[model samples]
Target chain A: MNRAHSKTKRTAFVVAAGLAAVTALAACSSSSGNGGGGGDSGPVTISYGVWDDTQGKVMQQIADKFHESNPNITVKVQITPWDQYWTKLKTAATGGAAPDVFWMNESNFATYASGGVLANLSDKLKGSDIDMSNYIDIQTKAYTFDGKVYGIPKDIDSIGLWYNKALFKAAGVAEPTADWTWADMVAAAKKLTDPSKGQYGIVAQSAPQQSYYSTIPQTGGQVISDDKKSSGYDTPEAIKGVQVWVDLVNKDKVSPSLQQMTDTDADTWFTSGKAAMIFEGSWAAAEFKEIPYAAQNANVAPMPKLDQPGGVSNGLGNVMSAKSAHPDAAWKFLQYLGSKEAETAQADAGIVIPAYKGTADGWVKAFPEFNLQVFVDALKNSSQYPSSMNSAAWQDPIELEFNKAWSGDETAAQAAANSAKIMNDALAAEK
Target chain B: MTSQLVPPVEQGQRRPTPLPPRGTKRRSLRHGDRYWAYLLILPTAVGLTVFSIWPAIQTFYFSFTKWGTFGGHEWTGLDNYAQVFHDPELLRSLWNTVIFSVMTLLGIPLSIGLAALLNTKGLRGVGVYRALYFLPVVTMPAAIALVWKLIYNGDTGILNQFLAVFGVDGPHWLSDPATAIYAVGVVSIWSSLGYNMVLFLAGMQSIPGEFYEAASIDGAGPWRQFFRITMPLLTPTTFFVTVITVINALQAFDLVYLMVGKASPAIEESQTVVYLFYAKGILQGDGGYAAAIAFVLLALILLITAFQFRVQKRWVHYE
Candidate 1:
């Protein structure tokens, strides 16, 4: 009888233990849930998400500045690394827990804006002191969809020719100039290449933004029509553009083989002094400045022209989630992010060229050694970065098809034709 | 007489113990124990239902639906499944998966041999040797792949440099389409060898030492005994190891993703089913198609594992 009594007591204890564990779990979750709720009467904290760890600190500073003006609203900066940024954002947005404000890029702008997840800023802008005209036209245009602005312009980037002056001097070749043409650049590449020393004159990477994107337009080709309904890859002009890069590696032997470039990226080759020149973006200035070898030797020139000056320009914009718990607070922070003071701070940091028209002068003057003006000037002739509703679907396949041409396994025309067929199919599917 | 005496004493002891607890009390005690057992199991049961079974059901349902980039999805029937069957990239990835599975299986024999060597009698510092071989097993796979990527680099890699010493120029190991999958397979084998070897060693040790002793008495040589006894006895372990290795190889993604990357020419030739699923589903936001690919892979694994179990009956001896 005593044993049965003890057994019942032990059983009761076990049940109680389990209940305790479950209660603790429930308590933890409820506490976290309460933390997310910010009543209209109380101070609200909104999160701003960005990629790029190097610029995260400056973002925090901007957030702090925003908080100083709007004492009732606190801004929290969240940094997700570039590789995982989109994947996290997609999952979070799907779960209705995305950051209140986040950085949006041109390639992905349409995907997010059309999904109805982004807050419509048109009405808000009309009531606020923020003028859309203060930002670059291309950026503002890129962020607008169906006659409504979804994002505020943040920064602009354009490609330029980054040359190693010391390598050119050693090869007895003249440094690249603003007026240089495609033929002149090719001739210099031949003189700069030294096979015995394992040095390449230039790196013609398969990257669209740095290499083929600029070249295709320079050769009078378009990646997509203005309506974004079709691909222009099969055009003779596009084929000619692809052929130029292929010929550099296969015929001229002035650029490293595609295999070599794949093993060591173009940026590494330039920074290591193994390549005389590379086509790079304005965003690379801060990274180059930190690399002593590259900073001492590298300078920028306008991208050499084919039919006309050619480059690709892309911009980032700040967007807010439509489902934000505190929309008013998020809008105030978003406006502050696009303000002249914020733009000047971004420009002074020299990490990027602010989208505000006159604010870029600070960025240009930040690095006096290099010709930062070339990046800003290239924007004038540059085409907007090509994108469609489902750009990623076609972009990957296009890169793979182009890689065959880069590897010399297929002719430039054949690869371009194949890319067009696939791109067209992807575009059709998008509808 | 002793058996008769023992039975009555045991009965006496058992009878009195039960007699003290009346039928009602005993029944109540059993009910109490039953409730306690359920409480003990609740946490694990809840966890498995929520994390594993729930997601699996969701994925199965999602395979028949098309998803928009952000949130909403539409019921698309077998459209995603139909596309999966027709995809050329899926076909290529399946072929790569097969080649990779076969290549990594080569490690099984290598592991068995190493395990035998380590199990030799009077081996000095066996612990140290085992730890040295097991280092890769404990290391993170991403770290291993990154280190191997550096070693497989075309120009400045230690591997190419070593090959240069022998006056034989090496092809680019990772960037070259012809060699990338094989290079990644080699790393997979190297990392998994320690794990497989440990299992084999345990299996070897479990075989009674008396078998070898008795074999020696019967005039059986070391090689003869190993082939006739150890190999046959190790069949069950070998079966388990083979099934696991094949499943893992078919699911190969992390090493390929980290080492070869999307931009490499080798990616097309080296991508596995999981890699394609990641690209289509996550990166490109084609969740429905990715779910379909996952189901296809799951079906393949189930078919292969069922086949392994069926085949093992002929060779695996429990006794």
Candidate 2:
């Protein structure tokens, strides 16, 4: 009995020893528990968070330029992938330790803005050298709420029909023009498809910004109502828009199945030369130009015309945390980020379309090989990326059922109706 | 769980007595060793109370309220729980987790078989064999899942390519609702086999060699010695492995997150309760719903563990 007792006691002591080491390490953290993010006025290394790694070089250049002028403040660029960025930011903001400055998008803007986590930049911009008039109206409106601006436009993104000229030439199909209609696109896709090569003519992606979002609007349906109180997914026009992709995938067999797209994404299929065409964002130009085949043969044209001509217009903004200790330094950094010089740098990299007016020339010339002007031309007739407060509440639920339509388990109308019901509940919850 | 690292004292022919009840009339630690013991344990107790127990209380409180953004919430008694009960997706995920736990239990016996084979007398090159089996346990699960995803790919994977030689067509394993859950279960079994085998090997090594020799001398063959001696003696280790494996399978998320991502068509069939909690809490920003899901999972695990403890009295033999 005494032996077993000694054994238990010995085990306890060993565990206690291990835990002691952990506690000592925990105590070694230099800062106390209650210190906030960027809570020092001394030489500070402010974390500048972004989602896209393709623009990491340009971001570093921007940071270097800022360091040269400020000399005391330093910025470190932290890249979190797009899929995890919002959730990570949400957790940090809820814990009251959000990064000083980070990228923001319209899809996730209202949640943070209305939650009082974002710093109001209206006062900061009032006396700043950055001209608000130089920025696009749509992007400025996206970053504003109740007469308070919480974000400064970083870059704009618009979708275009990126196609392979070599494939079109090989298939004896003419290259698509800016005024091409939906029928012309279908015919070209049919002509370009080569089943023996294990290749499809087009990849009909389910991506909101690149595919159905633009197509729905072109078919004379708004994703969100003007009052932002209702979803138009239940409308016949919206059903027709969704049906376009379904037909391309299941009926015509010109596009890969939904399952295939899930395995290897549309972007990969296009860049790998397995798909002749794709609806891609302007930001992908930098990534595609890195690939040899795509760099040589890929070119862009405006999204084809249907009942109406449009594409999804989305832009990213730089937002400051309301809880930042160095709000003045953060504002100065944000102002510099929105300056014409920073936009020019972003333009020369061809990573993204700059939101500042008259700065798209360098972006267009960055890739002298391709017709990059298509993205800028599409923006003229573009619609805003649809979003309301708590957009994810409905967006997630809708996608849960929407995939069934793409997989041919349900008709487009049924999916749209189900989507509308769930979307309405989410929209109602936002109020 | 206490570690098996320490050598257990062999008390002859007497079962272990349960520790005396606290506050009993005995020479309690209150007299002398209590202070040192308290000092030794102070750090762990404080860490648990602050990090674990405190957050549990907060999560419980949040379960009763609907959260907006940035810690904003309003009291809505039992509303979130009501939503959870009515949610079909939650129920489906719970069922999948149950199936996942039971399916993963298949690894326990497989590991025992490997452990016994390696325990063979004068086994040739057993160390190389053991290292090969333990590789999966040491590798990162994300990297494992990524490679498995390519192998399971429908159109161009090596798995389908291999199956083609036999004139067999393989379904899209990770994308098909009928196959995705089973595929995930198979991977779970593969990944956990090494860990369970190590535990059983430790247990086997602790057994005295004379016990097996005596059984063999009584005209018992190798299979008889295994069933009569090794199996009965290994009950305690088996119990621990079972409990740990059950808990791990029930809390599975990493493999599901990596293998069948959110875009997969088979998510409804393959997602676990924890994935639902993540989607609702972090992705959808519904903290109340997520808290409720977590409490439900806790209740389930608690009941299952209690039932296991009860069932162990029938089979688990204590020295």
lDDT of each structure? 0.85, 0.82
DockQ of each: 0.22, 0.27
* lDDT per residue as tens, model 1, B87-124: 99999999999999999999999999999989989999
DockQ of 1: 0.22
On lDDT, the candidate that comes out on top is 1
Model 1: CA > 4 A from native: A1-35, B1-30
Tens-place lDDT digits, model 2, residues B76-152 = 99999999999999999999998898899998999999999999989999999899899999999989999999988
Candidate 2 pairs with clashing backbones: none
Q: Which docking band does candidate 1 fall into?
A: incorrect
Candidate 2 residue lDDT tens string, A211-281: 67989989998888977899999999988888888888888889988888877778889988889999998
The CA lDDT at B56 in model 2 is: 61
**Each candidate's iRMS in angstroms?**
14.5, 8.5
Give every collision pair in model 1. none
Candidate 1 local lDDT, A1-431, one digit each (tens): 35544444333333333222222222211111112576756898888899988788888898898888888988888898998888888878877888999999988888788888899999999879789999888888989987899999999999998999999998889999988998899999999999899999998888989878989989889999889989999999989988988999999999999899988888999999999989899999999999999999999999887886676789899999998988888898999999999988999988799988889998999999899999998888877888888888888889989999999999999999999998999889886
Question: How good is the docking of model 2, by CAPRI class?
Answer: acceptable
Native-to-model Cα distance after best TM-score fit, residue B112 in candidate 1, in Å:
0.8
